[model samples]
Target: MSDDRSPSTPPAAEALTRCDALVLGAGQAGGPLARALTDAGRRVVLVEATHVGGTCVNEGCTPTKTMIASARVAHLARRAGEYGVHAGKVHVDFPAVQARKDEVVAQFRSGNEQGLTEAGVEVVMGRARFTGPHAVQVALPDGTHRAFEAPLVFINTGARPTWPDLPGLQDVDALDSTGLLGLKERPEKLLILGGGPVALEFAQAFARFGSDVTVLERGERLLEREDEDVAAALTEALTADGVTVLCGHQALEARRAEGGLSLRVRGPKGEKTLHGTHLLVAVGRTPNTDDLGLDAAGVEVDDHGHICVNDDLLTGVDGVYALGDVRGGPAYTHAAYDDYRIVRDALLHGTHRSWRDRLVPYTVFTDPELARIGLDEQGAHEQERPARVYTLPMSKVARATETGETRGLIRAVVEASTDRLLGATVLGAGGGELLSVLQVALHGGLTAADLREGIFSHPTWSEALNNLFMQDPVEVPGAQERNDPR
Candidate 1:
């Protein structure tokens, strides 16, 4: 399973190989799917152009979160005096942080490849293109082509970073998420272009690492998918961390300026030019289906190149399925893993549920982390659903007071009819963990009343949940003015 894709001379002719399953892109889903297919008594061939563990391991979550952890340590070190503990001046070794991230990624990726090898799954390192329905041609880095045809084909090619269409974009070198992680030296000032999870996470992390960071969000507000309160609190948190946030800003052009790169942007204020040492385009990602020749395989893709699939993850083609981020849903690793589970159950057990039933919990790796599951207050109102909202600032949480990390809020949405949990958002320290507690409650169909009466350990973040449900639900939007604050 040790694949080296170094370029070499091309082979004379291509040869075709037949297998029971041909999975494209050894990403979160494809990696496990290949192994499980082999275990199910089907021969599997996994084609990956790069690392086995996809973006999470190679570029996305693993590397970024690892660096975020280092950034967190640096942040805490600077804030040590808040706890009545004196600390010396802190300095960050950027290379050392990068090394640790690289090490963890290597371990995870190597383990993925090793598992595939042990499971008897053949691994091919190359670019895959569908030659026909249930058939693919892979061009290896050595200028050689290998072909695979299988009754069962899975598309898990994932995605790549896409830069916005701005003038002079190509003329100046701009870093995508992958390129940002590969920086040998931290930029004196980092200009981030986007307001999504990816953009904000890096914005906070790099700023904590002592870089001058500014985030330009085209939307009128950051985290457009979130409620105004949640987004505003995050904005305040980042501002307190010394990161400048400009909302309603559109980059009109990019160009080379003295000492580095420059962006000509139009904001709510007016047209202005900003200079920075590096530019990171974190606007969005495009699925890798562009060159996959999906048309040859009768697979359909959305306007954004995301493969469209049904609840069963089938692409409306016989024996072909699409999963993970490529399938056009929540682009989280857990969702991708569940996709493998769904597909595996259909393939093996012949029993599966609608994909819509799954819960997608996500966390922004920012300080006083932001975590969410199910719906939010705004979403419930948008659907005109009968739901009640409850909110508690982190300052009220006992553990938060004890830890001196109270710069966020906790919010919950409950079904007014059922009294059961509809969704929740936590924007404080250990927010992700808090989200997990709510996730279990939502999964168990526990009512907010149940949580309100539920006893929890004192002076703990989990205990804050008990207090979260103590307050009366905010008046339904449009009923009257509400007192709930972010």
Candidate 2:
């Protein structure tokens, strides 16, 4: 008798194709989540309108770091004479530096694309708008429409530079951060508006690259988010770098000047004109949530257009999630990566750790990188916690002395009674690397005594923390004796 289910019979292979997850805006978070889900035996569809890698790779961090490296080399070559080295005359070839940056970006983009393809994630290059809670309509390049439906949908469209509502500024033809990085030719002079990390970084970079740089801020000081002393130190560094920084200059109007652009800025004294070959507007960034039909999908957005996400990274709509810059948290790549973990756990495992468990650390990649993690003095004070502040100048650090980069300080804020590490600030050559120690101390729940007791390698910049915590409390002038530095 011939059996239907024989060994030679073809197996059940032709199953219906449907995705378990659909991720929009393939950036750091979305791209990795897609790969992780696919590895967990879930079918994933990752969609991107532009390149596979998002802004950070294509136009943000990668390009900025490349340009900064070029600037750093140029800076060192200029100062080689002071180090007892006879270096030849140096000239900055702007076009050549830009070309090198473009080469690096292109290689990274190609790698991102190749990785996505190899991961078996369907990378649809088109603008996708949510047509329903579980459905997305993608506008393909060939003028065709493709509808994808998945039970789990993730939005990670990231952010763009926000243009403010200053009158006539929109028609002034100014450049944002993205446009400024793509310039093949360097301007003779540049006028930058705002005093955040982007503004400060670009100001120093352009000045080093031989452009007469001027930064105009509406606030009372530069880098207002940092401590007053930290901002003052940075201001001094920028002034020494030949950047004409004008704080409290509220930009009123922008118009064409003699062969350039003129900005009418108002301050306490009066209105004055600031001229430049080009204007770089680095006010802030806004989430790219608009035009994506998030409202139709029942996803709630804050007043600033950022998607409202819970601690679990879930949107108001079930099975819909938002992460990265779109979620309106610390807009850093590492934070986005952590967000990926939270979403991945919620989707793949039974674990229930919230994104709030991660303490965010930030670093502004300047000459002396400004890095911070945990709460600062202000944050601790606001929480009504009795705090103690300690700081060590880089000039006293053995490593910084040997490296000739002793131009900053390391500061820590700790609870007086509990000794729990509250926050830290480091401004020095290895500020980025130094932040890791503070991050571990904050997240690992290590106290001041714990850090002071730890055996760190000698002659390292990080020894500053150990030295800082070992110091005696501030001495009272009238009632107490002076205590020496440990």
Output the number of the lDDT-best candidate: 1
> What shift in Å separates residue 313 of candidate 2 from its native position after superposition?
0.8
lDDT of 1 by residue, 1-486 (tens): 755632222223667799999999899999999999899889999999987999888999999999999999999999998878888999999999999999999999999999999999999999988878888888889977988899999999998888788998887789999999999998899999998889888998999999999999988999989989999999999999899999999999999988889999999889999999899999988888888888878888888888888888998798999999887788899999999999999989999776887778999888879999988988887776777899999999889999998889999999877889989999999899999999999999999988889988887899998899998787454322233363
> Distance from true position, residue 140, model 1, in Å?
1.0
Judge candidate 1 at residue 360 and give its lDDT: 88
Instruction: Return the TM-score for each candidate structure.
Output: 0.95, 0.92
- TM-score top scorer: 1
Task: Write out the backbone clash pairs for model 2.
Answer: none
RMSD of model 2, in Å? 8.6
- Report how far residue 476 has shifted in candidate 1, in Å: 2.1
- The lDDT, on a scale of 0 to 1, for candidate 2 is 0.84
* Deviation (Å) of 457 in candidate 2: 2.4
Q: Please list the residue runs of candidate 2 whose C-alpha ends up more than 4 Å from where it truly belongs after superposition.
A: 1-18, 473-486
Assess candidate 1 and give its TM-score to the true structure.
0.95
